[model samples]
Target: MPRFMGFVRMVEGGGMPPQALFDAMDKYIGEQAQAGHFLDGGGLFGTEDAVNFVVRKGETTRVDGPYAEAKEVVGGWALLQYDTLEEAIAGQQEFAELHAKYWPECEMVATLRQVSDEAPEAASA
Candidate 1:
């Protein structure tokens, strides 16, 4: 089975979902885990706790958030294993629908990216 990553982004200025909605999400995630669709997942703290780093030439610059230009931030992520890209996308759609149904007022986005099977090789001498 191929693996896919589902990236969950929260719109700027949107607060966390209510406890009832959070519980519903937890239940949905548990169902997916029990069905083997979910591999691993977790939510992240607000972007105010994040740090940004940029490397140019040989110099590395570190900047602390709140990021000025960021309109949205990753709020959570999930790793899913499926037989095909379409299946992965369908799964993501279902998850997004749950959010739409439960947190209608919240603005969120979910994106799916297929995971590569290739492993990195060591540098050649």
Candidate 2:
């Protein structure tokens, strides 16, 4: 089976409670796990977990925080294993549908990338 990186971008909504969001994600994790579709996943806080860097005069500056100014940022993501890209896409669509049911105003963007040999390895067995 081919593995895919599903980059899930959460919609911007400061009013949403983090706990509620996490609870929803937990449901997805549970459902996917039962289906054997979930390999790994995690949710992240905002720029607090991000790192920023700059290079000048052969010197580099490392800053801690979010790097992008976009209104939408990746709140979390999951890796999925499937037989083909179409299957991955279909899985993502199902996820989106489920999310919509809970968060009617929330929107998510899922981008699928085929895993390459050069990709980082999973730390767990």
Candidate 3:
């Protein structure tokens, strides 16, 4: 099975979603977990206290947020596993649909990407 990461991106300060959305999401996550599709997942706070380490010219500098230039931030994420890419796509689509159906007033994007299992040495080529 291949693992996929689903990122939920939206503008900061979107505020909490409706309770109905939360209930629907809870049920949806429960179903996915029971199906062995969801491995781990959680929502995240906005980048008010986010930290960034930048390395340049053999020196590292630490930067703190909230970043002024960011238009969208990852509000939530899910680690999932499936037998095929189609299954992953379908799973992501279902998740996105839940948000669309339950929180139609908000705008968001669901990004799905496969996790690479390659060893660091093999990937360095």
| Most TM-score-accurate candidate | 3
- What is the alpha-carbon lDDT for the whole of candidate 2? 0.74
Candidates' C-alpha lDDT: 0.87, 0.74, 0.94
> 91 in model 2: Cα distance from truth in Å?
0.5
**Model 3 poorest ten-residue lDDT run:** 116-125
- lDDT, candidate 3, at 9: 96
Q: lDDT by residue for model 3 over 1-125, one digit each (tens)? A: 89999999998898789999999999999999999999999999889999989999999999999998999999999999999999999999999999999999889999999999987665563
Candidate with maximal lDDT? 3
lDDT per residue for candidate 2 within 41-76, as digits (tens), equals 776678756786889888999987655566777777
Please give the ranking of all candidate structures by TM-score, highest first, separated by commas: 3, 1, 2
List where candidate 1 sits over 4 angstroms from the true fold.
120-125
Taking every candidate in turn, the Cα RMSD to the unseen true structure, in Å, is 2.3, 6.2, 1.7
The regions of model 2 sitting more than 4 angstroms off are 11-13, 17-25, 55-59, 66-68, 118-125
**Backbone collision tally, model 1:** 0
Clashing residue pairs in candidate 3 are none
